[model samples]
Target: MRVTVNGESLELSESTTLLDYLIRRNLNPAVLVVEYNGKILHRDHWSQIQIGDGDTLEILSFVGGG
Candidate 1:
């Protein structure tokens, strides 16, 4: 399956939940917000949402520096 992550195209061997994808990329769910297919998904739904082929995902990670 193919999906776009932050404007980069990637091919995944199998379907996976949003949480799994984040984990695979070494991302911390606690510090990031995800926009799936144009909709901002709540953190509570990340573990249950399945990523499908041709889907678009935008992952924005928070940075704190002051």
Candidate 2:
């Protein structure tokens, strides 16, 4: 299946969850915010939310300052 992440094309296995994809891509959830198809997904819900083909995902990571 194909999905778009941050405007970049991504291919994933069928029935892959958002969290699974993130892990597969080596993304750190502790520092990143995940949005699925325009809705912001809570950290606790990432594992349950399934990603579909043609879905749009946006990932944002927070930065710390001294």
Candidate 3:
């Protein structure tokens, strides 16, 4: 299946959880926020949320600055 991630296109497996995808990309859930298909998805639901075809995701990671 194909999905749009952070404005880019990617081909993923037929079935995979959101958490798995994040891990594959080395994204830390604790310091990042995922906008799944236009809605802000909670971290608690990442494991259960299935990433379907054409799904849009905006992964925003936080940075510490002083």
The number of the candidate with the highest TM-score is: 1
Total clashing pairs in model 2? 0
- How far residue 38's Cα lies from its native spot in candidate 2, in Å, is 0.6
What TM-score does candidate 1 get on C-alpha atoms? 0.97
Mind giving the per-residue lDDT tens digits that candidate 3 earns over 1-66? 999999999988677999999998888899999999999998999999999998999999999999
Of 2 and 3, which scores higher on TM-score?
3
9, model 3: CA deviation in Å? 0.8
| Collision pairs in model 3 | none
Per-residue lDDT of candidate 1, residues 34-62 (tens digit): 99999999999999999999999999999
lDDT (CA) for every model shown?
0.98, 0.90, 0.93
Which regions of candidate 1 are displaced past 4 Å?
none
Backbone clashes per model, in order? 0, 0, 0
Q: Candidate order by TM-score, highest to lowest?
A: 1, 3, 2
lDDT by residue (tens digit), candidate 2, 7-42:
999777687888988898898889999889999989
